[model samples]
Target: MSKIVVIDPGHGGKDPGACANGLKEKDIVLKISKYAKDYLEDGYEGVKVYLTRSTDVFLELSERAKFANNKKADLFVSNHINAGGGTGFESYVYTTINGGTTEKMRSAVHNEVMTVYKGFRDRGKKKANLAVVRETAMEAMLLEHLFIDTKKDADFLKLDDNLKAIAKAEANGIAKALGLKPKTVKKEAPKKEAPKKDIPKKDGKLSKVQVGAFADPKNAEKLAAELKKKGYKPFITKE
Candidate 1:
């Protein structure tokens, strides 16, 4: 098995990323990264995984790449949700692999991730020297897996099963990139529906229900939890 992996969840804090139907790219990829890490670690032995940030904190793009470089990771997977009206998944590698055999790495990832979602557009191999891709030393792939602004994308991903499917596909993608035999995806315990945001009431009574446009669904859930603690019912709505 490939030795170490670094997963970077893009955008956090002030950088809310794309907004649509109350979902933010930061929160979406955070959920994916956590599950991907779990999917990989449980299914493979001697594989160490680390995330650049596990929460809604922000980091410069370059800093994220540096973390992976510092670790000398075998593979660096930068997770991001795409924007615009487009649908589908595309993987990016540096325009030049600095003479490294990284394009093959990118191809492996592209092939596996595109396997599950047939409707996804094949944005085939492209190049860019983004901070994460250029500065990283090891093989790396930045995934533009899905567009968060579109309902069709959200409808598919919001389902718990779809999220697990994505995680499995990503884990397999990395294994394939490193030219390792694919491993079985460890099954996830079924996840419940995402909790809703809360609303406050007047007249000295906390309302049993409230929902708001959160820009980020996870943020909405966090707000909901806080409201519930304050005796308000909360649910989240999209932009």
Candidate 2:
């Protein structure tokens, strides 16, 4: 069975959410959401993913929820960056939703994202009657990646590695929860070539001079720097 996921990047365009510490929630979440979508499309099989808003355009909360409901999506993930004091990763499900797959998804995504942002506190799976979770017909959850207000969190978000890691984890969690499989990659066999005739060996004694040998490349670099100062062009090679 094919699984469908709708990724909603919260806030956009004119509505730049929580602009603090030189980071914008809307922009950061959009990058993460897009990354997740790309990962699912490229790596996961039997899965179809869609984004509510691909561009930096404002979208109504109702519209986002309705899009998933109308599409009959299997899962809905809303991405956002938090602000206003607290610092950490948090995932939320609809408060009215009892213990079920949706709740399990919340836990899965929370844990996966936390693995990458381990520095931040794990806020744990929470419950709230948010529009995206409350109105969507399918399993839905909202992810607050990190606090944009907190300087530490904001700095972390600034790193491209963290964003990519968070996106990958989110996709992986969703794929696992939905029982989706990864796309099969075929490996090509090594090509065989016929044996070649041996060539005549050169009869000459080559003379070479060694400058220095060091296990650490930094030491070799330091020697090279000294050589350059002495008006010599030094080249370093790895053995």
Candidate 3:
């Protein structure tokens, strides 16, 4: 068969990886993994994609790696968000057998993810005993793209457009590292449909929405408030 990719969105169900101001890392990553799969399928021909869990369910780290090894993946990219106060991004590969932290597979994945997300501070790649990286037989890397609990990283990640951009850039990075070229993402944002003449309004005020109706609404609203505090009027509506 052809070289395939196994994408794992770590954490799920009850194990909500990180929760900050209402955002859940597990759920967010799942969406990103799906976005990446769609991009690869439509843009990169013959590169099959497999996800460990498609729904909001949990998978043990061992099972996560087993999925990739069982599928004989050429690359495995596990998606995750950070917690606590860390800023910027980090990627991990298995600790090398020799003195060095990695071999070629580690270098390729680390270079790809970091190069694509050039704006974020380069935290540098390191050898980690992470389950997903070490256990997977295939070349593998795990990405912690921005912090969900930090004030700065969380703010940046709160926007749907920004999250999509990050995800797409990651897809591009993976493609580049793996020697595939991701097709040019469209430059234009799709025009929004005009609001219906008589759509019903809710709550006589804004009601808290259960996220996924849009991405990162809690953080998104916080950012909007910050923007307004700096003299910009921002609006919040479901997408």
Best by TM-score: 2
Give the alpha carbon lDDT tens digit for every residue of 181-234 in model 3. 555568955567433333346745433333223376787788777766665446
Candidate 3: 10-residue stretch with minimal lDDT: 205-214
Model 2 lDDT per residue over 1-239, tens place = 67899999999989999999988889999999999999988988998899999999999999999999888899999999998889998999999878888888877777877889876798888899899999999999999988998989999999988898899999999988888888877785445643322333476443445789999999999999997776556779999
Candidate 3: residue 210 lDDT (0-100): 35
**Candidate 2's error at 164, in angstroms?**
0.7
Error of 3 at 115 (Å): 5.4
Reference-based TM-score, model 1: 0.71
lDDT, candidates in the order shown? 0.79, 0.89, 0.75
Each candidate structure's TM-score, on Cα atoms with residue i matched to residue i, is: 0.71, 0.77, 0.69
Report clashes for each candidate as comma-separated counts: 14, 0, 0
On the 0 to 100 scale, the lDDT of residue 38 in model 3 is: 77
- Candidate 3: residue 61 Cα off by (Å): 1.0
